[model samples]
Target: MRATLIDDLPDEKLATAVADLVRPGGRWRKVDRGYTQAQQWIVRWPDGRSVFVKSGTDALTWGWLEAEIGVYAAVDAPWMPRLVASAGDGQGCGPVLVLEDLHEAQWPDPWEDTMVAAVVATLEEVHARTAPAGLPPLSDRRDVLHGWPLVARDPRPFLSTGLAGARWLERALPVLEAASARADLSGDALLHLDLRSDNICRHRGQVKLVDWTWACRGNPVFDTCAWLPSLHAEGGPRPERIAPGQPEFAAMLAGYFCSQAGLPPQQPGSQRRAVQRAQAAAALPWAARELGLPDPGDAPREGVPR
Candidate 1:
């Protein structure tokens, strides 16, 4: 995915902004991870310094980039990625983010025990930090985070996934709804709403989290609850085995994934549906186990860690 001949790309605005730090003769290669609207790159200057760049390819990513920059500016933590410089604001060539290069860092794979422990420890420290001003609280996403209501409003999307038959879904709807309603996502802990293997890297004994567009504040427990589903899908421990004992929160997580697992991606090359379905596979069964609900069947899982 290397874009040789730097002159062939249209990064002039971003290049100019970082000209002092990243010299003109720098080379960059696309990271090529899909599911994002931004073009990510690892750029190396002739002077031997390197930096990661995230340039928005569309309006959605432009807004996301702006938010991510704010998160980096507001939080100074060991787990937070270093912010080098930023440019654009949706007015010129979209928004761009410059960050410390993490290419040499180890990204999680095979769900190693020590790495998992490091991640959890990092999260614990994150939770202890006082949230930056203007960060939204977890309660803001109460209804929005609750997925059973969405499924209840329109069961077609959930049903299409074949994770549960029509009869099974109908029989299980009441339990799902009740369990979700019992979830109260309220607390003052700083939160990383989006936690996945790709957004994480361990460098020099520190776990750095990239992609801050989804950072916020919420129940500390909710942060781990939300993460374990993806962890489970990636051959990590089940949500119950790791965090355990948050049946209501587990139901809410399941509902959120199930509600969108069968929907169409809003953009081309997006892995939204597949990832959501894969997460639903892990979360639903975990929720059922916690709540003693009936089986919700199964479907072939997709979007394992990459």
Candidate 2:
């Protein structure tokens, strides 16, 4: 009863794989309630040290997690947790990771401006470092959100309901297409593409980032947008959605600019516009597919959004 894939693979297969990865004197325990996959677990060693583990076999997920370790290691910031150990190749059944467990740390709820600022500033600092000129580029918005077959073809069935939702989705399409046109997969930055609150922790008065599945080199603005949904989800004392054009976003940008020094700030208006555009671009294609609307085919703007 350790952990098993949602693909309905036999529990024995998963247990065997977990057993193979569990080191001597280490135990893997199931941690129910996962966002991405069903087999998430906390691996505990006899010495009382523990690392979190998540598994998947689609693309470069295991490799991406490893790449995240590389990103944090390369950064000079104090915000990232130390890497422990990871398992898995590119494919098959048992690929997983065992990393430092920052249990005492908790995520910033509703992502207050202060929390957003701290993360933005930290990312800015991370982005400032120089790297080898050509690292294979990280996946963009489409790649991150829609790589799965269900997501790639259509997500509206899973994301929305009713005609009103459909209209909102429709209104958002052209903007999505336009923004995607500007997406450059070749752009590089110190990116934690999945910068949601769950993957971040506040430990001993320091902020630490975890969950590097979507980490990569790319445009920093794209990084901001990628983090936006979760940040918006975390905004406010009660933890509600952050409305577009709020002062909180301004503060977040202020913190990022403060850390970045020479970086030009994205105007709040422009950022909101970009958000709306990105939302549409990010959602519409799949929505159309979900609704049985014919795919418009890949235009110049139909590629992944950076």
Candidate 3:
């Protein structure tokens, strides 16, 4: 019963955990937003200030959390939440990050025209910022980011997902693989590889993007390219409507999701594979439409929100 009232944590435990970050009277509630393995909290002080906090407990979660903390420390852009405080070793492990609470922010699920415009505008702002030094280039991530080549090596996994029919796979895989190779992802701009509704919010009349662990330096278009597919998956406009005429990007994004959709879940109980299938479902058609390739008649509509 106490847990029900306090979001599964006692107020005393919350205060003890972040004693240095907040006043003694503050209370905290666990937040269940985004796809992070780190524990999240929204702590409200007696003075009416609130902060968002996350503790890096999981091994993988700690690494990503460290990267996010570095991005926060390096960039002072309005497109992200203000980093309030952090505590841990210099290395990226066993630490907690405190950020300006965005509990009041609007998470645009059923996106509107104006909201979409806000996100696009925010992306432009984000891309205009130079990536921090020491960050890896987008090209360094090709092994994981590019997928059509893997599909070509062994079509069985991708074929099992049913995003495209066997005939369509045999015919279209080469074009997509080739197009993926041609997509120039090289640039100095900041790229948020993960872009979805859960990672974005409209706050203080502007777009604030969270989840920066997958960030890298790449062509600015990569931001828009990666975003549009997930946008459509969540009921927004098609990829072409927001940013027209980037077939290479469409192909790349298509493969990024399609190749992983049929594979077993990387993490137990993760819905990411299903979401990838849905993103593939969204991207394949867009790629065909933009590239002037024939319709992927074998494409299945069996995908969920990415």
Using TM-score as the measure, name the better of candidate 2 and candidate 3: 3
Error of 3 at 285 (Å): 1.0
Mark the regions of model 1 whose C-alpha exceeds 4 Å error after superposition: 1-8, 88-91, 298-306
lDDT of 1 by residue, 1-306 (tens): 112223235467666655644456577677766667787878786778888888887777787888788888888777887888776652266777888888778888777889888989888898898678788887888777788888887888787787776666766778988998888777777888888888777999999887888778878899888999998898888888778789998999999999889888978888878888999989998888898877676433332222
- Tens-place lDDT digits, model 3, residues 128-161: 9899997789998777767998887777777776
What would you estimate as the lDDT of candidate 1? Answer: 0.79
How do the residues 97-211 of candidate 2 rate in per-residue lDDT, one tens digit apiece?
5556665465675455676667767777766654434344554344333222332245343233211233333443443333433344446566666665667777777778776
Q: Which ten residues in a row have the lowest lDDT in candidate 2?
A: 254-263
TM-score of predicted model 2?
0.56
Give the Å error, residue 104, model 2.
2.6
- Winner on TM-score between 1 and 3 is 1
Best by TM-score: 1
Count clashes in each candidate, considering only residues at least 3 apart in sequence or on different chains: 0, 6, 0
Q: How close to the true structure is residue 128 of candidate 3, measured as C-alpha lDDT?
A: 90
Q: Pairs clashing in candidate 3?
A: none
